[model samples]
Target: MPSTPAIVVTDLVVDRGKKPVLRSVSTEISAGTVTGLLGPSGSGKTTFIRSIVGTQKVKSGTVQVLGHPAGTKPLRRRVAYVTQDASIYRDLSVKANVAYFAALYGRSRHEAMQAIEGVGMGDHADKLAGNLSGGQKTRTSLACALVIEPEVLVLDEPTVGLDPVIREELWDRFRALAAGGATLLVSSHVMDEADRCDRLLLLRDGVFIADDTPADLRAATGTANLEAAFLHLIRALEGVN
Candidate 1:
């Protein structure tokens, strides 16, 4: 992984109508690396992602992307966020949707088609996005994000509803993106996906339980896998041996 910090969060605190969502979270994600945000549902994973992308408001702390404040104009094209919900135009064809996003970035139709192919949605390019299956729609959404060639990419539960094959394909694409020097932060509740990442940030109850490499996390917890390590960490936090 590159030594430079691509994204930085310092003592972040987020609240949703008086209920704490993220509690003093802090971390530095390196450039040109794929970092997994692993956590259970309602563990502040999505909230933390929004904070990094500069969409969610925070009660305290600071989040910076590429040395500037998150969500600022300078980082607009440099950062791309793909939420769990596919944010494409349902009425538009897959190609049209992706091309429209490419247009926004002043990219050409060729680039739009290239992005669609990059996500393995080339065969379904002409299909209406609304008629696509869950996995297809997710890939279509990813194509839109890839059009910008962002420096930092954030994905919130991108593989949650995908099948095994599609999930594996997406992970491969993620690895390729990182290899090209883009910093990627992908969130997933599935423990099996943990090994696909270069580093992991484990969140629980609005705070980080652990932050380390997959192998190191397993070794530290004396577990055989990430799921077991997660459970062991939780039990230890609850004063269980």
Candidate 2:
């Protein structure tokens, strides 16, 4: 993997109505790798993602994507954000939704079809997005992001409600994207997904508690699994060790 950093954040501080969501958070995400942002449901994962994507306002900090400031016009085409909710037009066909985004990036219908198939949505390309299942909708949303071929892709709990089979399929696609040199930062509250990442950024209540690989986390905590390792960290942080 390349050693260059795709994203860099320093002292990022965000607040939601006087309550701090992320406090003095700073980290570097390596290029061409899958990095997992793991924490509990309210551990500021979404807030951090919004900061990187330039959607959420921060109280203090600097966020740079591919060397440019986050949310700048130049970075718009190079960075793609797939939200937790499906961002497709409910009334449009799956192919049409993907094609629409493709057109925005000056892509062709052929490329759009390729992106649709890349997410394993080829069979449902003609189906209305509103009529599809939850997993199918998520796939369509992913296809929309893939059509642009972004250099840095940020996903927020993409597999939240997916079954085992579909979740595995989506993760395989993520690995393929990373192998193709796209940097990915995926957020999840599920500790089991930690091993799927090349690196891990563990957060708890707006503070970073751990940043290491799955193996390193296990080794440091002397735990058999990531879930147990996470619990160990939490307990240590709370002075219960």
Give model 1's clash tally. 0
What's the distance in Å from true for residue 240, model 2? 0.7
Q: In candidate 2, how many Å is residue 157 off? A: 0.2
TM-score of 2: 0.99
lDDT of 2 by residue, 1-241 (tens): 5789999999999999999999999999999999999998899999999999999999999999999999999998999999999999999999999999999999999999999999999999999999999999999999999999999999999999999999999999999999999999999998889999999999999989998889999999999999999999999988996
> Model 2 clash pairs?
none
- lDDT of each candidate versus the true structure: 0.95, 0.96
* lDDT for 76 (candidate 2): 84
Residues 208-230 of candidate 1 have per-residue lDDT tens digits of 99989999999999999999999
Q: What does the lDDT read for residue 241 in candidate 1? A: 83
Off by over 4 Å in 2: none
Q: Candidate 1, 24: how far from true, in Å?
A: 0.5
